[model samples]
Target chain A: MKQGPLDLSQHFLEEGVVDLSSSEKQSALEELCAITSKHAHVRDAKAFCKAIFEREKLVSTGIGLGVAIPHVKIPSVTDYVITVGRSEAGIDFDAIDGQPVRLVFMIAASEKQTAEFVRVLASIVKLVKQNDVRSRLLEASMPNEFCSILREASR
Target chain B: MNARTLVDHIRSSAATGRLLILCVIIGAIAGVFCVAFSWLLETVQYYLLDGLAHHESEHPVWIWLLVLPAFGGLVSGVLTTKFAPEAAGPGTDAAVDAYHHHGGRVRTRVPFIKMITAAVTLGTGGSAGREGPLTQIGGGIGSFVATGLRLSNQERRILMAAGMAAGIGAMFHAPLAGALFAAEILYREMDLEHEVIVPSFIASIIAYSIYAQKAGWEPVYAAPHFHFRNALQLLAYAALAIVLAASATLFTRLWRVVRDAFSSLPVPTALKPAIGGLIAGSIGVFVPDALGTGHHLLAGAFASSFSIGFLILLVTAKMVTTSLTIGSGASGGKLGPSLVLGGSLGSIVGLVVQDLFPSLEIDAGAFVVVGMAGFFAAAANTPISTIIMVSELTGNYQLLVPSMLVCVLAYLFVSRHGIYDAQLVSRLEAPSKMGNMLGAVLKTIAIRDAANHTRDLIVVPEAMSLRQIIDLYTSSEQLAFPMVDPDGKLTGMIEGRDIRRAIAEEGVADLVVARDLARPHEVIDIESTLLDAVQRMTLTGLEDLILVEAEDPTRPVGVLEHQEVLHAYDRKLMEK
Candidate 1:
């Protein structure tokens, strides 16, 4: 299957809503769970969060250049999915640039799709390097606008 | 010519013309040094062996085993401590430090110290390569020349690169590889402007030509040619690349381990090298091929005559010798020893695989060359330079594809953890905080403070006429003013945009107060962090942000913008 920005939406964004804040971590986690439970096949948002947290403990997914790519390989999904989220308020993810992350791409993939998942992740990194595309995504106001901006960028 | 005249002459020459001349000078100088360095080393070897070649009948191998390394270690220790301290150990770090921080200037005395010390170290059988010292020598020459000419920082950097290329070309007689090494490995980037490329190429070619004339052009290695008979062999080649990458990592780790161990010791610094030499010589007693640079042994491996067991022994011995020699504080290059060790590993792998699958006709030597480049790329993180170096040294462009593939694979494998630990620390020290803060402060002081001071001085009745507000901007530098309606609420802000756009397009100067140019979202709350303020600016793509009191949303506190933050940080750094 040809995976693109839609796959990212399904994997990263929990529901139709994404929460962004500076001082509160729990609110962000709760919002992530609410969104995932609505859009994701896995009904347990807590388990998904646990897996992502474990991955983060291994190495900060905040690769330099103001980007954070957090991923997990979970048995709950039979296929791979990726999602992107923007926080205009900026979250402290311990990024290499010492700058808080404004964009997050969360990925969930099955063991069988490891190579394909990695290839897609590399492509996403390349895509985000475009200054204009990143700026447009950061400025997106709502879920519909965010999705539209991602779709146009991928195209 | 006088120094000033010489500097002026160099500066006036077209970039290409100056580079060509510099390259020729570097090449000639490097070639002479290489020949002298080689001869001096051979003399030490002869004295240590008592004028007897390897197969001499009566000479006790034990005498060579004991005396040579002891002498090498002691000499290296004394030379390093007494003379050029910067020339101690492997030359790579010195080059990197000079390039990044020293404005591409190395002391002229460094090359002389390196040549003498390296020759003595290699001569008595110090387990290191000559190439590293030669690179330092070349780099030093470039630095000295540029400094003498008083060149601009950019020009000096290019000249230093050119000198390094010339040195590599002279030492290896690989011109193209030398040029690429300068642009790729030394710089750590492939994107080069005309200014860098022109000089680098000229220097490499000149160095190669001079060395070739003196040495009569020796190929790095000679091998029997073989063609792939089936697609399965390509798979074998891919497998070879994977193994090479892993081995490269091991080599890099071993070097680090030895360096750390020696450096952690409490002994007097000068004596450390002697101890390393003693250990290397003890190892050399069992494996005689580990004595010098191992060029002869590398040549032997390509002939399919070196046994797999012997190759393994050589690899271990060379690794220990090189690590100890360099780790302890000997002045030398890691490039030659790394290539030799990596080539031996590949050759052994090829021999074992061919033996198991007797039907497959594969030349192990071809794998050796590819392994050399692959290992260098992985260890050094310079794939382009390694690829080009291998192709140029062997004069075999046909191996480019395999070389490139192997190099890239090896590079990726090693990069997961990374080879250079120091680079990670340095990269973390970017000027991000200072830059951002300075940008913010500058914007505030330049625009906001001036406006606020004017507002305090200029007082008008609540029902100010449009003519008076226009007169305020006309009489002073405050082009914009916040207008408060009679109810003490800030109704709007007026600026040049409204007046100029009206005058230019509508052709009317009907005057208005600050309320005319006020946009709905021009104000920000006071409680936000500086990061928030910066993001708002970034998102709106605006030059300024108007600050309003949080308790009273309509009342203006002050304005903050890009320049305010920048100026503050700039002043802070200047004071420091």
Candidate 2:
């Protein structure tokens, strides 16, 4: 229910945090969609990937600080969802600061999910704004380590 | 030029070899349907109005006149509101809407429901026209027959127009004008639906012949022989055109205002029409000429017995009563009432002109005919067809020069405001012609050039209460509000749908803030191509409402509306 705050920790699955070997920004989005599409909320993985790429065409969602957050609100996305894909090589995301994106945070929300969608998005904004959050997230070598850092930082 | 030139009106216009045959079949059926509707209208009017109230007689029974239309409105209202709301208001607009938006699809039951309901509304003295109801009815027939034959969407739309032509041609007894009306009425500007012209002609001729065979080949109004020879008469005709243009504008605006007022009432939608009929009936108690479609008054105005003062009063009364009856969700058309309003006003102007030019032998009846054509031409944005339609309806072939001048003048004077709201600006903008939007134009324009710039942007503060946002939503036209944090940095955005969903889900608005309702909104850089924005908009099923920003997308600069992109694209194509 959108009336109450979303439990951020429960939504971040350890398996979803992947060390993505993507050469381009588009490939990075594909890798994240493949992982997120496996979740119960996404109706189709291929369509979701296509939608994310389409959203990227307008303007790069890569906010500064080596973080590219590509998000879409679509009918295919039945609930609030997120997946983290880290490209160690740092793909060029055309960010305003000209920083190569080391971390790709993908968000997918339902067309109708208002409160919970906004809550998840705002939490990500807060998490990305943390002083050392990106460096800590990039340095983590394993998926479980990445999850723990996110969980602890969020708490 | 010798007889009939099978000319290709447009380069891309569909080949009408098989379509012509279908038009013949559809036209025949639509013609018989028109005759049946006319007969039904007359039978009901004779029994109900003549028997119960003595409607047209001198010193008529008053109480019966007041109750009959209200009762008729109650029945017709329930029929349209309960079973077929598509039949509500003017039927011609619904028919045009279906052609342009609904892929030429009309539900199977709409025609049958419309026929019965429209007859009831007109027969019991509701101040509405037969054109709208019959157009929808005939259009439904065409849609049905075309769908049965497994036609394409384009073919179906063509057939639908043919049916419309048949209905108008048969009912108004003006076959050629009816065909032209069907094609011309679909667009507001000087443009016509060129593809529909020939097929409509075929259907209209067939329908008119069949109806004439049964109902006698007489024009609706018989006018005395009147000539327009004097050069001084142009002055009078021009003044008539200007006044008629003004009256047409007034009629269209009045219709919308009255329609909105009735819709805003808390009563059941079905009961609204009954209330409208009650008001019209009360007006009819003093002026019975306004109670029904004012066709008979047009005939009377041309005769010698009717005074100029009475004709002027009839014009005002007809405009008011027709606005009340049809605007309140009753099934009817504006075309028939417009004829009466224009005819009476023209007659009044003609008398005034005759007084001015006492030395010249001038015929006032010529103005009556030209006035009918001119008033409708401006009101409905159908100049060419209305001239021919009015001429044939009056059997007045001698006044073509005056009719043409008046119709064209009135059309130019009124410009774009007309009765049919569904009429598109031009063929380029019609939804039915989506294929005309070349894909190459999309790649030619940039977001910076096409995006809409607004000075009064409504930016919702993240800390602002959701209750405050709701108030903003009510007061402003902005669809998406950009949400800024305490530092005034763009954090997120709240779409119009987000607020609607929150209200639908019954979220506590007082407790939630703008931050709680804002989603991770998509923004486009000013450098993006129109094609890039369009691809995203279509794939995501979102509007062309992406925010435009500078180097940093979060720093919003403008809003890219899809309409502006389309306008730019259309302009580019025009340059080619």
Candidate 3:
């Protein structure tokens, strides 16, 4: 209940992380959104997935460094949330850098929770940019280990 | 003021200060040009008409007076039509149109072409003023200088106005009036282009001084000793205002009538001025006083030598001749004829008032000055310039009170109808003015200030059924609903538009899940500026964008609706 400097690792639950072999951008985004939907915070799975697809039509969220951030700020979110998916084969996301995205961070948050949402996104990007953090994240077998590595690097 | 110091100072100075210095230089150039133009016209007229044959003589060869103006008109028409067609008609209107619509860009050849055309037209006895051509020449110079330097649009517009003011100031030896004329002539209503006033005034003074050095420091006309006399004279001036206003209206209407008549004629467009010149030349030969700028006739009226009947005839003849000359596209101004008509009308009004009220010592000269100002105030919607210009031209500061009163009365009576059709309502209505205003506003504010907090919104679950979603959608006025999974992690969003589309489709009755039709929405960084958010929305064609944390691209914070951006803009405007 107490808000602090936002932690990116807090949003990544065990079920939120998944190994996705999907090559297409839309399917990868849908799988990530589905992973987040299983969390208690995700109130509407259909509405949430639709928002992500609609956002994709505008521009790809693939920010490069083998990372794609498909984010949505919707009224259906009760709190800030993020779903992490790792594809070793790399998904074909139309990123600005043009490299296939190996990591996808599908984030959804309540309309009012901008502070936490922004902080969480900044922490994730900072942690992911570290060569050690990225390599360890890819080597981690489970979502818990991936989240723990993120927590260590973010600190 | 040293040359080296001045150059260094200008290089280090700000844009506005640099522009003022440039205006002074432009004014000097314009002044020299105006004097040269006036001298050219006078010398040509003397050689062609006066020196060739005695204009006052009854010699049969003096019949050339009847054909000279027609020949001049033909030459002027050819010059205007061939090189710079925009130089045709009153040059002030063209200058005005350039400032309002053309970003103050006048063709380089316009000033030269107009000068030649106007000289020929007026030199050969065409009844029009040289003021219009000088104004265009000055404006052209300003446009040239500003364009050469690659100045901003706003700075260029100001310089153009300053150039026009310099021309009028130098031409008539009325620097203050000329400066005001440039600012006032841009609008038909009671509005001034105030930004140009200071630069224009500086330019006018510089130009006036240069012209005075060559032409001597004398007003354009000399008036007899005239006093305000008594309070009773105010009533007479008021009466003169009414007469001038009526005559001004009639003058404009007659000009239009003559022009329309010539336009509809079977003759070639270039030859129309020749025909007009023939009629005007015939009128001039009968009453030579009505020809040219009529400055001498105006001076004669102030001396109180003309009989009442002769003054009336001069007014009618001057009006008709001016209409014929300018209406045929001879490339001269209406200001000189307007002053002539107003002065003659005032002379008549003065005579009648003195005769009717025997006790009142109403000087006819005072009436003449007031009449000149009043008629132009109504006809050209230039009350301030008319008062100052008339007083300056005659060196009669004592007549200011009466001139102001008459000018106001006439200006009010004439309202929106004026001689310059290119004049707009105000600077506020100009496209360039609005663009500058809006651009300045958009630059000051950022997107962070306009964003709303995410805690203020309603969050919907991604598990909600379509029927339940429909019930909630129908119950509330919310346009967008953010979705989350069972573990409370954000997934996507559903908008009212998506729901409507689904309902319109067939075989979708059982497909009620909120996630099935969810679409991606644009995401904006919370740290991004408000202008960036607005630009993104415009670029992506979205009415709303989702705000995310700057550090974490995947995390959503709040929704920034288009209406909210507009509301912020409205608030900023109100503050302004």
Query: Which candidate leads the pack in DockQ?
Result: 2
lDDT, model 2, position B523: 75
Candidate number that wins on DockQ, 1 or 3: 3
- Quote the lDDT for B99 in model 3: 94
Tens-place lDDT per residue, model 2, B1-576, is 422343544322455567898899989998889888988899999999877888889977888778878888898899998899999878999999999998889987898889988899899999999877878988998999889989999889999999999999999999999999999999999889988899999999999999999988989887748777777778778899999999999989998899889989999999988999999899888888888887877766676447788887788888888988888888888888888888888888888877887766666777888998999999999999998998899887888988999999999999596999899998889876765455557877887777655466678776676668888887876767777765666767777767765553332444345655666666777787888788777775555354655666666666666677778887887888
**TM-scores, all models, native as reference:** 0.58, 0.64, 0.69
Error of 3 at B478 (Å): 6.3
B1-576 per-residue lDDT for model 3 (tens digits): 899999887776777788999998899889889888988898878877565534544452346668877988898888888898888878888999999999999999999999888998888888899888888999999999999999987888999999999999999899999999999999998888888999999999999999999998988886637768588778888888889988999998999899889879898767878889899989877787777778777777887788999998899999999999988888899888888889899999998997899688888877888888899999999998888999899898888899999999999887577888889987778877885666566557666677564666555665465566777778765566667666655566666666665444332222235554454557788767667776787786666777777676555677777777777888999997
Ranking by lDDT: 2, 3, 1
Q: Residue by residue across B85-115, what tens digits does model 1's lDDT show?
A: 8888887667656765667788888888888
lDDT of residue A103 for candidate 3: 86
- In the range A1-155, model 2's lDDT, one tens digit per residue, is 23433457767788778999886977777788899999989997778888678667645677777877777766788987778888878989997588898888788888667545655655676687776887889888678889988878766
User: In candidate 3, which residue ranges exceed 4 Å CA deviation?
Assistant: A1-155, B1-13, B52-62, B264-267, B436-576
Who wins the TM-score comparison? 3
